[model samples]
Target: MPGCNNNSRLSAEEVQELKQICRYVRKMIINTVADAGCGHTGGSLSEVEILVGLYFRIMNIDPHNPSWQERDRFVLSKGHASPGYYSVLANRGYFYEGKLADFNAIDSMLQGHPCMVKTPGVDMSTGSLGQGLSAGIGMCLGRDKRGLDFKVYVLMGDGELQEGQIWEAAMYAGFHKLSGLIGIVDYNKVQLAGTVVETLDLEPLADKWKAFGWKVLECDGHDIGEVVDTIQKAKRMSESGPVVVIAKTIKGKGVSFMEGKFQWHAKAPSESERKLALEEIDSCVE
Candidate 1:
């Protein structure tokens, strides 16, 4: 609400506007991690546009009433990326901007991973790799049972797809035709240990989802316009089936040294590195 307007489709001007906001989110993410001295960097950076696209321009959410029943829900299955998550929420006015300074500190509400009980905008407390999609399925099914129509959006790391539970949930969602649920894979291709190909290949990824009965979509995760269009198309498919947007992204997207580097998966930038990263982000907007 603070940065972007809600829309199913965006004009060229709106897309550029969202891109600038996304760059800001990326800057905020690294700064938050640097201030805390520990946080996921690469994955958080890669998914900034995806998160910003959803929170700023797509989802029907209220910053003032985070518990509003009609509000769409979002689950960051890759929960270690709390720096990005917290920064986006703060920027969206769900909480005070100053709280990000306390991230990961002693007894801080903003933990290393998301805790729904403690965090104002977090819908589900998540950290375990393969559980978030299953939880999203449960949310969708429960909403259906209650006769509610709010959608549930879930973001997962490509590495996390190796978990069998994800496929299980996929199968279940497909069978039930839970079209109100949308899944986003941050297919940055690089994960904690190494490349996703070396770690666990999700290639033929869209085909796999198709086999599971999902209406598969793809996009450049960092491209705000394409991402928004894909989400809008997915939302328009309630009569079809569950949708999974395989968003291909570069890990550590905006910053030069960090981009595509697996070592930055969970490493915070040092003081000098932080300064350099911020400069890179600043130049992107300029």
Candidate 2:
């Protein structure tokens, strides 16, 4: 059993710092998509705060030693949006910022999907939909059986919920009483093809989780304060099976033209569009 005695909790100042990092991460996503000529900019932007809250405030990670036994685990099930995840990882000292320029480049560590073998901070190589929760459940169960108290956090796209496997994993987590596991659904309402509601609705999503015997909480994914608070609440409620935090976010949240539009899901920004995105993100900075 791995000792969970490490201090993973963040102070109020650290929360503020994480919020700032999220803003930079959003900018990095916009720029990376613009430079790469192809990427999931919308969904990536929508999950910035969630990633930030986890990496900086909630998860017990050591950038120096990513595979530390006592560290909490995070899996990005929506792996196409690796730009955002990579940005956060880099900002947290997993790698250098210069590495971001090689994103999606041939033979680069930054592939379109997260590759645990290639990236240093990535815990699991996830790209296929509906699999991350299962992996998270496995980690949670492993930790439990080992008498470890570290938590496992999994982030899923809303569209991914349409897959039957997601529900199965949810049920399994609840049935096993994997209280140390936490799943966050990025409910951006849009998928690659269209709005999640128009494609395959997962409405009354929170209720569905509750029905599975898991504690469910909802928050604004873009709001750093709310996201942090919701995660804290989930951590404290771990005694009652697993917990799911449904975060309502806007696809392409920071960019004006891209926000709320499904077109930006996997669209690369054109040269002019890149300039516009940079301008928009620059304005958001203090």
Candidate 3:
């Protein structure tokens, strides 16, 4: 986390600013996804607070020096959530915010999935479900072997837990006691096809992680304060092993009609619908 103020907590003003960033990022996601004509919308919208909490508040890193050796690494295992990821990186000054609308354009730097080689701030290229955690574990191990100090955070989708590779990586991290690796599951419960319960129930999910020998934390994913605080706790938690925070979220948060609806998972908004979604988001400002 080179050149970052590694503060353990946010002051009142900082918290308010972080909340504002989350709201703005939500609008950016709508605009970016709408401009793309088609993109993942529901999960992107749902993950707003968690990403904002990390980028704007918790993680330490220099946007200007994205390749800094000490920079914290992030892997979006649930890579379909690119709309949200791109919006954050753009707004954080990793690249031109205007160009975000060019997402998925042929040969554009911003494409359907994150590309570490193409994107300035992208730590790892990821889109394949269930693979990012394994990559993150390797990063943690790399840091240890190189005697470098930095954390690796992996954000995953709840439905992604069904991937065997995820468990395999979890088991490896647990056995090796990679304390610098943190896994965050966006437990929104809804996927492109249906609810997680109807699709693949991950009941006793936290316990499963515990069984894997990782520390477990759960919080309201949409609550900026809670998300930030929980992450800070994970950072300071005893170095017993890797930590996983199961963040409970809503698939389509903020947009009224789209909230919790699977149909909006990859649905692009019509011009009118985009405007309406923006207006709805504006009304929720507190």
Q: Which candidate should be chosen as best, given lDDT against the real structure?
A: 3
Can you list the residue pairs that collide in candidate 1?
none
What is the lDDT of every predicted structure here?
0.88, 0.86, 0.89
TM-score for predicted model 3 compared with the true structure: 0.97
56-115: candidate 2 lDDT, tens digit per residue: 767777888887887888999998889899999998889998898889999999999999
Candidate 3 all-Cα RMSD: 1.2
The 10 consecutive residues of candidate 1 with the worst lDDT sum are: 1-10
TM-score, cand. 2: 0.93
Score residue 13 of candidate 1 by CA lDDT. 84
| The best candidate in terms of TM-score | 3
Give per-model TM-scores. Answer: 0.96, 0.93, 0.97
Candidate 3 lDDT, 108-172, residue by residue in tens: 99988999999988999998899999999989888889999888889999989999999999999
C-alpha lDDT of candidate 2 relative to the true structure: 0.86
lDDT of 1 by residue, 80-134 (tens): 8888898889988899988988999878889889999898999999989999999
Worst 10 residues of 3 by lDDT: 1-10
